[model samples]
Target: MATESRHVTEYIDRPARVVYEYAAEPANLAHWAAGLGSSIRREDGRWFVDVPQGGRAEVAFVARNDLGVLDHEVHLPDGGIVYIPVRVIADGENAEVVLTVRRAAGMTDDEFDRDAAAVATDLATLKQILEASA
Candidate 1:
């Protein structure tokens, strides 16, 4: 069955490379992504982060690149992998970050909207963190 997906974009007053360099680091997810955790720890060659709901999650990042591609798969506690695609693009001297969130099946409309909002908030935090540092 086809699923619902949405994309949210945030603009930051920083260069794309600077934003990408910081955001691309999987270690920084906890600082920006509330749905993830406040701290991330590496164990047994795998990276993990604490979830707000009292559990930890496994995060497997894609191969690093220089083109501002920061894609990773979050292994949910239920054995489902949520693929998150984040991009940092140059907009003049500034940068724009775009995130794509895919709604899982059986999610109610309200739940879907909430998930999107959470992502937007996280992206905003990311923008704040990056821009403030610039």
Candidate 2:
């Protein structure tokens, strides 16, 4: 069965390479991705974030590549894994960052809407951070 999904995107006034480089770094997530956590830490080469729901979630990002894929998997404390698809697309002199938020199994409509809203806010935060730095 296909799950409901929404693409939350933000146009960042920065080069694709620059945006990708910054966003790809796990350490930088705390600066823009508050929905994930307020802070992130690396232990034994693994990235962990304090989930808002009260436990820590391990975030594993795909290996860096020339392609703009920033896909990652979040391992929840309850043994559930959520796959998040993210991408950085070149837009002339700027870049568009898109995050695909999927409605998890058995998630309610309100929950899905909230998830999308949080993603949108996070993307906007990313845009502000990158554009301000430029």
- For residues 53-104, could you state the per-residue lDDT of candidate 1 as single tens digits? 6677899987778888888888878788889887888999999999898888
As a TM-score, model 2 comes out at: 0.98
Residue pairs that clash (backbone atoms under 3 angstroms), model 2: none
Q: Against the true structure, what is every candidate's RMSD?
A: 1.3, 0.7
**Where is model 2 more than 4 Å wrong at Cα?**
none
> What is the C-alpha lDDT profile of model 2 across 1-20, one tens digit per residue?
99888998999999999999
lDDT of 2: 0.95
Runs in model 1 deviating more than 4 A are: none
Which pairs clash in model 1?
A: none
Lowest lDDT 10-mer window, candidate 1? 49-58
- lDDT on C-alpha atoms for all candidate structures: 0.86, 0.95
In terms of lDDT, which candidate is strongest? Answer: 2
